[model samples]
Target: MLVAVLATALLVGCSPRSEPAPEVDVTGGAGEEPSLEYTPPLTISEATSEVLWEGTGPELEDSGPVLLDYRLQRADDGSLVEETYSTVPKPFTLTPEVLSADLHEALDGRTVGSRLLLLLPATSDTSSFASVMVVDVRPTRAWGEPVEPREGLPAVTLAEDGEPLIETPQGDPPRSLVVQALLRGDGDQVVEGSTVTVQYTGVRWSDGSMYDSSWVQGGPESFDLGSGVLPGLAEGLLEQTVGSQVMLVIPPESGGAVGGEEDTLVLVVDILATSAPAPDALTEEG
Candidate 1:
């Protein structure tokens, strides 16, 4: 869920790939530097319908969905705000229902690898007075499937019903596989527009100390499918028949948004439950 944490609310907010690696981030400071020249504000005519962005790599246009490498900053003082480098692309689907006409007008059909600065008014008194967001865009390949592994990471197989299959030896208490299925179901595995609930533990690829996990605390973690999680995990779950336990070895790139220093991330994930949204939930949105 890319939904901004507005005190206490989550927002749920795709694509294909290729090419040389993209550069990840930039460093800068808050408060203005005396000699540096800032780009002048463009007139509405100059802004046009095309979107401009900041990034390093080939510019992608008409590719399916776009992955983004970005750094948000303060416009006035040019201060660093936030940064993200992910294996998956962030989406920018625009529609009036989800975005205001002004926003759609600001970001439709923009080219990839461009850097854009969008100024937004603060929503409340406690927030900053204004915001300047810099975005770096890169489009994905249509129907973009994740890269298949040849080496580096170990792999898991899914059952006929799309649930992850656990290699097991008949034993009491099911010592090998957990009770719940991770990524199980009788339909298209890992649909883009769905929510999935599962339990998982993540370990550092290098030394194997746990960095993060929902399973250790007990209870499953639920998230919307195909929403910029590690591609391998999403794809692996899609192949399962719901209600089956599956253990997975996640390559650094496929395990989380940011690449880990370890060679691979090992996971024991159990798909605990699934819930499909109502038809209205499938509407095209920003």
Candidate 2:
């Protein structure tokens, strides 16, 4: 839900509109360096796509956390416009706005580890440009490694689909915020200001009313922890290692934000990944 992520926690989700993957031609297959070559049609008037290579991994579901390495080129001449080959594959949550309608139609039901090429027909609208995107889908974490459920505080359980089932603990809510790490990762520690990608769920401490859930949305969400976020979230997330799942019980907001200011908030944050450290303005004068 793009519902005030600063005031509310950001989660991922997709709409009910989706169709089966389309069949198309791709130049390369899995286990090889990915590549795609699309010959522009002589009578191009519509967008079209083909699967350059098929992945043997799981078929993508409607709501997704798909990773892709894509190269964009002009549809008219196939001239390179941009690419992600130098860097790592990027993550694309299967949300309604993740891509343009034409591209979304191309990606529906594509498998993890598949490669695809999308060819766009010249646009009648002046606001957009026609282009081709060569995409290499990669496998990403479906779920964090399971850890023993911690007792005390609210008990957290997982559904068959990996969505968190929070059982708010009985007792007077903590006067101060609480942070507890459930699972740990060997990846980079979450530094202050690092763009952190995570899956999370938030609920009101009063009646256990869920306010947000990434699992429900579709996949994981990324946020800059260093930005002016909630005191409870910044405190709970800063310096925590990536791949760690932490629980936070906040004692109501004292100032600006979404959600109830009097209602104590509870959050289960899973630090799935981190990237793009905030640029340093602290450099000494050269």
Candidate 3:
């Protein structure tokens, strides 16, 4: 199920109290499933959060999508309600409209790789029981072991947040497709006809001018490898692993042209996640 935070309850006014925030013993490191230990029937007077561990990654500065692994529990009896750690991590936008005021305030200005503990008091609108949540911030970009590209390729540099900056080489673009891995990942290999989540920057090879970018678009994008994508892009991404950074040099014949005009395209793609198409989806494509 999608994670949803109700704001109406968070906005309810609270009276001042002398009691400190309830103690929630969180046991686990970042990137792993966490275990929560606390007394049952806990009572909270206000919404509060505590940073369990600090992160060293880039600071969040925008409302872009932030990936998170979290566990939510019922505070009245300490029973698990929902969690993402045993499965896939979920991405949430850090906007007031998307998250509760308390959640937004707690997550805002925080860096990636941080873990936080949140307590929400019972509200009349949604639930009569309080809620406890443990959140682990995950990186929004590709991260893996760096690999050096071969000579004569465009130079690729990274910003503090892992956004790729591409510099076209000094000669004519390659005649055929070129796929080079800038970072090697340890995840599963991307297969043909699968869906992929990626952050990418596309630029014209002739003058190094950018034409498209997922970073500029505010977040990563998901694409189906079976259709609606350039032939060169699909071919280059096949067999690549998740968590990898790849550079693809596409010639004009491979859907690299702009407005049917001959132009090579240089793309730096970060392979973040991939999943096989559903059985019905594959049948429909077939």
Candidate 4:
């Protein structure tokens, strides 16, 4: 039933004449019929400085357009409400063309990075009554650490320098990842600055299916170590202490793949070796 509703909502959302409605519930909870005239308040969760500057920063004498990346949460329970990282105005303009009347009245001339709590009055039958929203507005650079970093997992270990290495197979995969300990390193001959060569394999988390691998091709895939790879890959390889095995759960968005399906990816990599090739070696023969 929930899937049906979500599928319907997605279809409606893509309609040409339709406007995407914020996921505001008019009734507030499951099965409670909504009042005919209840409209929720409009709250700004996050915005780029550019949007705030043109829309609300006119009062500042030397304000340059800034970009805001923020996390919004529900004021009621503090549960994450929504993320507008890629919204049309993800880095939307505060210009006249982009600013809505509700925003103009609520945020015009407001300070950048200021947290604002506001209400949105519903305009129709489907709208909800005034609700609480917490907006943490900040410059675009503020977008950091999309996900909280977890401590080391027993199944996986990082070299002294923090690069992750997977434990060699003792028998079979563990039931789940187990917390281990933090790793510290000597920081010498580290995989930090130079291009480190390694082998890797990818598998589907849901069905344990192997999707792609550089190992199958025989030789380890040689990237400049850190260049041209996913953040997880870059971080994993660079910080990995020499000669360690690592397992990584790659989110779809970071995997350079099209996503919409609900599933995760598992990556197992072995740091076979690390070498800091000479500068001219880039053009030199292997």
The numbered model that scores best in lDDT is 3
Model 2 steric clash pairs: 12-217, 12-218, 13-217, 24-50, 26-52
Tell me, what's the RMSD of every candidate?
Answer: 17.5, 8.2, 4.2, 20.2
- Model 2: residue 106 alpha-carbon error in angstroms: 2.8
Residue 91 miss distance in model 1 (angstroms)? 29
Cα error, candidate 1, residue 54 (Å):
59
TM-score order, best first, reads: 3, 2, 1, 4
Global lDDT of each candidate: 0.40, 0.61, 0.81, 0.38
Number of the top-ranking candidate, with TM-score as the measure: 3
TM-scores for the candidates: 0.32, 0.62, 0.75, 0.31
Q: Give the poorly placed runs of model 3, Cα more than 4 Å off.
A: 1-28, 35-44, 62-65, 74-93, 124-129, 186-195, 252-262, 274-286
Candidate 2 ranges with C-alpha deviation above 4 Å: 1-58, 63-71, 75-98, 112-115, 119-130, 136-142, 175-177, 215-220, 252-260, 280-286
- Global fold similarity of model 1 (TM-score): 0.32
What are the per-residue Cα lDDT tens digits for candidate 3 across 91-159?
667876666566778888899889988888887875677888888887778887999899999899999
What lDDT is obtained when candidate 1 is compared to the true structure?
0.40
